[model samples]
Target: RAGLRFITCHEAFASAYSDGTAVRVTTDPERTQAEFARCSAADCEGWRSLVAIYRRIAPHVLPFTNMPLPSGAAAFHALRMAAGLRGAMLDLRHVIFGSSGQLVDRFFRTDAAKGAVLPWGFHQDFGPAVKGGAAFAFVAALSAHMKGLVVAQGGADAIVSALRRLIEDGGGTIRTATQATEVLVEGGRAVGVRTSTGDVLSASRAVIANVTPPLLFGQLLPAHSVPDRVRKRAMAFRYGPGVFMVHLALSRPLAWKAGDDLHRFMYVHLNGKPDEIAGTYAQCTTGLLPSRPVIVVSQPTHADPSRAWAGCAAMRLQVRAVPAIIAGDAAGTIRGRGWADIKDAFADRIIGQLEEHAPGARDVILARHVMSPEDFERENSNLIGGDCVSGSHHLDQNYLRRPFPGWTRYRTPVERLFMIGASTWPGGGVNAASGYLVAQDLLGQASKKAPQRGIER
Candidate 1:
């Protein structure tokens, strides 16, 4: 809470940063803004409990929220949206000899490590989801003027639109059709880029490549400039499976077997237990989706009504696994019994599961968009075949080990070349924290001559 100097619920409608401009929260075009106001700040508010309160609850209590307990069936579903606690739940390796092994006082240390790194970076390394720390970080950056209001291509349309307003407000340039091809380094000195259009645009300050690791090291910078360790690691890097997303326009909000309010966000899926999760991960490791895959179902439409058209809801159902999920190759999979023919046919089965968790699922579904891993790879190269995180988020490939051993802070061996994407540290997604971090590094360098303001976190 102390770190979060500001939180931007909606900026296009209202500049959260006090710049003598604040739009009314209740406005027509800002309907999205109004809806965002309702979606709870699950992180900030839930941190209000005392240490004693936490002592009474650890594994039983979700670290992000202080909500009530979930029923067994609901808890099973919640595992998918978990901050990645599938293995932790069944971990008896270091337990104190045949104890019930519940999350008691002694196990507080398990969550302690989270507190240590978490308070620093927004990518808290929990699980599939984030704790809104990046939002706080970006809003703080905007307020402090450390980073520009201009946020480029963060997957979320709402966030992108608000940032666009800020960029346009600041009279900043929004260059499009400019795909950065290669970094032009002269005698180990940082130079600029060679765009696909053959335009040689030079950065007066720094060269930050906001693309994937393979693209940055392999494509943007030359092979020679990259160190062996970086090269070896990047080469060793595993490009995980693509994600399959099902976006549905529902006719009404979902009805859930709700125990706690937060249960609404709890992800329900098919896989039964740890063995199932393990088997799924194993299948993904070798290249295949688990026979019965685990799916994460998030109804953002339930939380934010503006996400859909009038009388329509948006359903986001996703699963991240290897190519085998989609039968390796769509053509081959379809040729014999393709991933699509199978998955599309099974979509109704998934819908049946959704109907159980969300009573109104089938009844409300008006139109649907099913996205497979193959589809994702074709859409965004950054996704690297639906590995939405640029690359795998495994322990070995995460943190300092990310991209390369020594390269973490967006900088490469070649002078002035920096990185800023999900591929970069504190990796991945709508979190503009990576861009802000990279921007801070760039602005600090840029201010050395251009006279910019003091750098802030």
Candidate 2:
């Protein structure tokens, strides 16, 4: 483990565009209304109302700042308050099933709606079962508006570099390209690990696996070592959805038809009405790729110019809520061809969609790299089915029930074996809550066993 230093950048701007009109989201609450005024006068009032609801509910939903999220009764109470319902019990299931579209519909008139529901879909890792929520979705959007969109100075790789430095400086050795074959269990305890390269590394304290539940229980450990019930639960672990990423080295920045102000934002969501998002989710669940998938167009080079060439820029385009395996194509252009067979065709469709908002996006591309769900799975075994979050964040798969119930504290049935990462509580994103919690628990246990040293007593 390493003690890493982080350099933070401000989330200065973000935007959501639909029907050629863009609503700018800023960190400054006062500027938000003015910014929305640039998009539409009718929607300005709706935006204001949405922000008001966010202010009221955000505090209740995210009660703690620098601590682990509260669970059980306290979590239930917070969720109820966040939902703005008095006397009614609101659980995560209610939130997940409840329509965020309904909440948006209440705040914004049909004509005034500019895809406000889109942010919730993207923010909550929108999937078939995830309908978004009044409390969860609103809080996610509000947090972004309040905190602004922040990124590392030199891109995400900068954080990895800093962590690597910390590890090396602390005399920790890192081995790459070594596949862990089995978790060596001795006397009903996780003692060490055996690698495919015929090397056995022993753990003095514990062995923590930052892997998906299936791999951790099914592959990394002997079949006879794990309990049947635990193995069955792991096998039943459900993945949310996969993402298709296209990284481009643009000859120049995107020229939005709306205005140059679009270049200031870190992310621009290209979505339509709330119903469109719901349709996409439905398609994904049924194993069909949406004809018009939600595209999260990120201009990282706009935030940190150092990432690209002197006169060019770098961009990342993400298509979310797509199936990992190809069952059918909603567009009907590439049916049952599989990701390997239709990855390029799918990328073309994605590029065409981008061109709708940012014209000449295809012409400006100097180079492009595409990663389909299949590619993602090959790159990281833990990303089962290319699910970016490792597992679903649905009601049954989140929080204390994550990776399966009764193992919330990162402990396994086998002593000294622990689990962490996206599959655990505080699921997904750049936040390292899972790792931090596990480290604290391990440290506390270690301190308890330390030999006392008092002068001569």
Candidate 3:
């Protein structure tokens, strides 16, 4: 195992959500229900029932989190899921196929209660109105309630540092600033890589590409080496809504109108009501900037103060459902044609909304950094058009059909060439399922060949 250290999060709250009024979702189920009860007694009961149902189906669904689907595990999960559906016929349909909005509607009556859980549905590129979003929403809320929020002590770079140590300690070399221009092939098999520096580094076993489909197909693997159908599908791979990021170095901590207790939670979502959120999704997908953006404000310093200077806070605002290309502004305030021309103006709108929740928040800002869709692409080519998730997680583009239909097992058309990353199955986030599954598979294949080669470990 790769050794990584994590800081203990706040004991009280997992996150806070607000439409106009705020609701703090506590780590304790009893306390969370109490918060829901403030909305309505029915919501409190609904929350309890939802939790019980999630516990039933989570065992069936969570296995696929760390493993690829369509395997024995997937088949077994399907059988269990089918059984669950039979037991909770009415509720399970909403859990699986209904939009997140509809799923919450079944349980919650007030906007505050619905707003708290609805934002989880937008964890990916999808909106709360999209079908299959309920699955994501349910899983995210359950995970938060069960495990609270976990953060690396020094930030994500700490995890990367640990991985770097692991790789180097295992006698692996990592070359920075080196671009892999081509995957060298020989006799219908991947052999190595040709880098931008005109150096060809040979691989003894396989070449794993942790990149997008477009970069993998015609760009890295030459057209002659790949089948036409595979190449076409890869070329046609769809990217979802672009994401925009704003980092604020606050001179003082944010003062939430809800209370000082709100500062304890790592995430605070400025999620309007369900219907408003649906409209925001509609605006962004159609290439228009939403009048009111759904914002997730992450306060890392709340969990780990080491991330910022003494007495200061480092806040990151994540805005999703943004257009890859700007066509117009729903507010009709900006006249810019592209993200570059309008990012600052758009960021201002985001900051204005933040000010409404936490007054004097803008006054405390010591410094600010904004990354538009174009900026994200420049930072990482895999984030095409600033689509932080790489590819859409829509049912058509996910699971068995991820990256494309013929290439779900991480194996490509060229033998010994493999693909893994956010673009592959079990898609996105920090879960390294694709990497682990591919490694296990390669090891299995190696074990089978070891007997023939007269090799011993």
Candidate 4:
């Protein structure tokens, strides 16, 4: 155990959702449904049905989130999953093939409830109408309900600290500020890595890379060592829409019109109606900055009061589905040439939108920091265009075909070389399943290859 502290978020019950209107939700399905019923009675029944189905299929579906695909366990799990979906077989098919918009349309009757569900899909960095995006959204809902918006106490750095401690305890050295330039190969097998400083680090067994497909194939591994097909596919990996984040150090907590109860929750999704999100995604894909962007408001201080200064709060507004490159502004207002030139204006625009829900939200701001898509890419090259998810989770790019069609096993063409991280199977988020599965594979192989020895006297 890492001795890490956690807050289950049950005490912080309300999760706010707004699309011109507001709905307060909690982990409790019945209570959450009741909140929506105030707006539309039909939406209540639909949510009841959705929750019932979720309860039935969650046992089968939740396992896949952390489990490694392309393994024998996965095949067995699939069989169990099929049995689990016995009555809901047709619905399962629709979930897999249909869009998130369609799924919401099938269940929710009111725009209020639909808006709440639509943004869950946007977290996958795709339009709500994109096929296979519904599954991602539904799985996310299931995960949230199951886990109750879990947060590591003292912030995300606590996770890093725990991992660092674990690695060091295991006699593993961590080199920060060191960039690995190439994965060294000898006799068609990966030996280690050459750092940016040209220092060669040797590995006894394997060299695992936590990098995007493009970086792994195009930059790290020698072109001659990789198969032509694999290399080309990796090179052609598509990233989704970029993210624009704004951090606000508030003199006081946000006063939401939705209710003071909402201040308890960490996250609040804003402007997330189906049509609105669809239009925003279309605008971003066409190289135009969205005039009305979907925003995820995070008030981590609510969940963990220690995260902020005394009597003050820290908030993060993540503007969803933004263009990686500025071609034009959909609003035809801002005429900036680049994201750097427009990010401040964009932050103001976003803050103005926030003010609508939380009256005079701007007045409480102690300070603000904005990270444009360009800034995100500069901070982490893996973000390639600020796609925090590393790569797209489109049907063609996820599941068995993740990273590459035949490379989903994490083992690459080069022996003793493995790939992990957001670019691999589970496809992003902070679950760490990719690394865990790869470690299992390597340990399994090592155990199998261990030579048998006779008992000594």
Better of 2 and 4 by lDDT: 4
Task: Arrange candidates, best TM-score first.
Answer: 4, 3, 2, 1
Assess the local accuracy of residue 311 in candidate 1 as a C-alpha lDDT between 0 and 100.
Answer: 65
Q: How many residue pairs clash per model?
A: 7, 1, 0, 0
lDDT of 3 by residue, 90-196 (tens): 66667667778888898888877888788888878668768878878888876787678788987899999899999999999999989999999999999999999
**lDDT tens per residue, model 2, 201-262:** 99999998999899999899888888899899988999888988999999999888768778
For residues 1-457, could you state the per-residue lDDT of candidate 4 as single tens digits? 5868888775223334443346666678667777779869998888777777777777776688677777788889999889768888887777777899998999988777887677888988768778988887777765565567888888899989999999999999999999999999989999999999999999998998989989999999998998899899899999988999999999999888888777677678877888788888889899998888888888778778888889999899998678888999999988886998999998999999888889889999999999998999999989999999988888889888888787887889999998999888888888889888888888988999998689675
- List pairs with backbone clashes in candidate 2: 11-149
Models sorted by lDDT, best on top: 3, 4, 2, 1
Model 3 residue runs over 4 Å out of place are 1-3, 8-20, 80-86, 89-93, 451-457
Q: Please give the lDDT score at residue 404 for candidate 2.
A: 85
lDDT score for candidate 3 against the true structure: 0.84
Per-model C-alpha lDDT, please?
0.47, 0.74, 0.84, 0.83
Please estimate how well model 4 matches the true structure, expressed as its whole-model Cα lDDT. Answer: 0.83
> Which candidate would rank higher by TM-score, 1 or 2?
2
Error of 3 at 196 (Å): 1.0
